[model samples]
Target: MEMKTIYFAGGCFWCMVKPFDSFDGIESVKSGYMGGHIENPTYEQVKTGTTDHLEVVEIIYDDAVFSFDKLLEIFFAQIDPTDAGGQYMDRGTQYRTAVFYTDETQKMKTVNYIESIQDRFDKPIVTEIRPAEVFYLAEDEHQDFYKRNPERYKQEQIDRENYIKTQKNLS
Candidate 1:
């Protein structure tokens, strides 16, 4: 089986894991920091929005079973792509939505997918499409946070779902 890796910065890294975890081809979903200037930034540093790092998830999967396009679809559904500032209740550059593409094919597919869905929203999609950068693994406390802290994670999911519903109604 050929495995491929993709990185996605979609709001709080904690909220990004569970959505992709249950998929058949998915190998692992790890919380990490990317697109940052600092080396080995901690969650505290990135959360401050000063390290220039965005909270991201490093996703590894079997490309033969799970396609990149499917991953894009899942990513887009999780956050408001039009929100340039941040997502849900999290407000910061670190919470912004982005697709960190690792290859030409991933780049092209993401660009096209964004374009095709442009008409669906009144606002322009602001999700960033960029080359994959070094991914610094987040603290152990952050990995699988939803599993570790179910109540907190559930509350976050509720808030995010409500916001998404409201946005859909507006558009």
Candidate 2:
């Protein structure tokens, strides 16, 4: 089956990567930086707020198994679109929320989705929906972080915090 691509920046590419990877239809998720003026900005350079980039995750998924709309739904649930600053625990211009669409189809779909949810929030959605730019993959160490260090990564999971604490008798 053919696959489609969607790129999103909701903050901490670490947190963003796992959610998409868990989706049954998703083929893969890549941590990257986008919407920036500089080319191939390092994690440090971007974090310093020198570059305009936002930490983004590029998702490759089978369109047959999951629709673009479905992906957008999941993305919306993961971050506060109205918060133009940054997501949950992350802060900085590089961690700001954004939606990078590859084509016109994805662009229109994103617009519709944002419009549908507009009234649900008091503030306007600050998510920037634009054409996909060159995506610079993060360092190898950042890839599959959750799988490599179960204990540490599991602790990072917002939902798994209580579960892990209880198991470790630290609750």
Query: Pick by TM-score: which candidate is best?
Result: 1
lDDT of 2 by residue, 24-143 (tens): 789999888888898888888888877898889999988899899999998998887977767655667887888999889899999999999999987899998888988998878778
Candidate 1 residue pairs that clash: none
Per-residue lDDT over 21-94 for candidate 1, one digit per residue giving the tens place of the 0 to 100 score: 99999999999999989899988889999988999999999999999989999999888899989998799999
* TM-score to true structure, per model: 0.94, 0.87
Alpha carbon lDDT of each predicted model: 0.93, 0.83
Candidate 1 has an lDDT of 0.93
Q: What are the runs in model 2 whose C-alpha is more than 4 Å off?
A: 158-171
